[model samples]
Target: MGISKPSRRGFQICCGVTVILLIILATVFTILAFTVFKPKEPEITVYPQGLENITFGFEGFLNATANATIAMIVGINNRNYGSFKFKNTTGFINYRGDVVAEVPIQQSFVPARGKVNISTYANFMVDRLISNTTFWADVLAGSVNFTSVTTVRGKATVFKILKLHASVPSICDISIFIKSQSIETSCKTKLKL
Candidate 1:
């Protein structure tokens, strides 16, 4: 059957309106769904507080062994999960702005939780060499500053100092204790200085 031109025009208009309404409904539903179920943004902090509280230790003592000399041992322990890196580690041994001697800490790689020890000795020929031993102690006990960078996994550095003093005619012994987040699997020594 032949349809009237006016009826065909009406049908076309209704179809267009229906399509437009469908598009508008779809857009509104999408926006609502996102607002109701979207996840929140995450917050991350790079540097945390209490890092300044980190500190290092130092100790020294006089020994009157057969050689009548002075011996001192100092060490830094890793107490964190990650290994620490000390920049300019060799220059840490200084006394009142005066440079003395520096020895490298022999630690291959301090593991997630371990400690490393380093020691140095100065021997004098005389039995009553008070100045030499005292001078070394003063130098060793002073504050030592170094860049302690922690590992990405979680590591920290801890230090302890032990000093012993004895008469030049008697033998003296010194010990240092250290605790840290990381530990080393093997002992490693530096070749120079």
Candidate 2:
């Protein structure tokens, strides 16, 4: 049997309508991706609470040692249209450019346009702070300064299709007052996508 002319015409019309509809949908999605669904850098804040179990004295004849626990809270604010999922990472606490403590960060996730706060405790210990000549001067001044550095590695997934790898680096400068047993902190962060 041979196909009729009217049926062939109807089939061609249906295919043409489908192609036009697909083109329109593609254009709409492309526009939205470039405008509404664009990615942005997340904001980070660091708050240092105080020092716990702080003890500093001479271990032996002319040997000085120190031990304490640093309590801090870290906040992550996600402003993007996607969720950020990060892996486990380690943070460093530096005194005069020397690493003196390690902070361990567990893997976690931050929802889109949401915020999360992480509470961390890092043990601060140094066997020979007296070896550094400036250590005594800093103690006599009643306050000591330290720097904290951390990097979070993650992937942001938008609409379950677009995946962007991101690295967020945070740096915090902290000052601890010995007499008042107080802490002050300032932090800055950078995002790499």
Candidate 3:
């Protein structure tokens, strides 16, 4: 009787549909698992070291500068990322270190942690007049106390420039002001030295 054709048409159609549905379901589940169960990559956040203040003897500065400079000390709290083009670090000093003006350190260096005490002329303002008045005010007032200046990045020693020569007081009298906040800080340290 033609073996009744065994209802090949209906059975074949059902089998085809089942196979297709299984494939679709598998694809969907694979996509979901990849998106949801995959592990995420780790991220790192480097907390910058705080150089709050500094105080170095004039003799040390003289040796560091390699040139005759005023007798003064200086300090600062800043982020000297690296020996970049003087635009990344955010520290300041009363004395005219290597950087005459406020600059930013734009480079990266090793030892992503700890302090440095290298001496450089990048923060010296050079020979200038020393005044009795607070130097920060003059800086805030926009007085050009120096022709050029450089901001230095040192190791363990932080030089603080409090006052210039008390004798003539016209060689290099200066003061500095700085304020920077940390990652979790609400109030910043406003220093005057």
Candidate 1 TM-score over all chains jointly: 0.24
Q: Which tens-of-lDDT digit does each residue in 45-74 have in candidate 2?
A: 777776667877886898777877878788
Model 3 lDDT tens row, 107-129:
33222223333222223333322
Lowest summed lDDT window (length 10), candidate 2: 123-132
- Cα error, residue 98 of model 2, in Å, equals 0.4
| Best of the two (1, 2) by TM-score | 2
Tens-place lDDT per residue, model 1, 51-167, is: 112222334455433232233343444333333433323222233333333333333434334554445333322332223446446336642221211111211222322211211
**lDDT by candidate, in order shown:** 0.33, 0.84, 0.32
Q: Higher-lDDT candidate among 1 and 2?
A: 2
Number of clashing residue pairs, candidate 3: 44
Which numbered prediction scores highest in lDDT against the true structure? Answer: 2
Model 2: how far is 80 from its true place, Å?
Answer: 1.7
| RMSD in order of candidates | 20.5, 4.0, 18.2
| Global CA lDDT computed for model 3 | 0.32
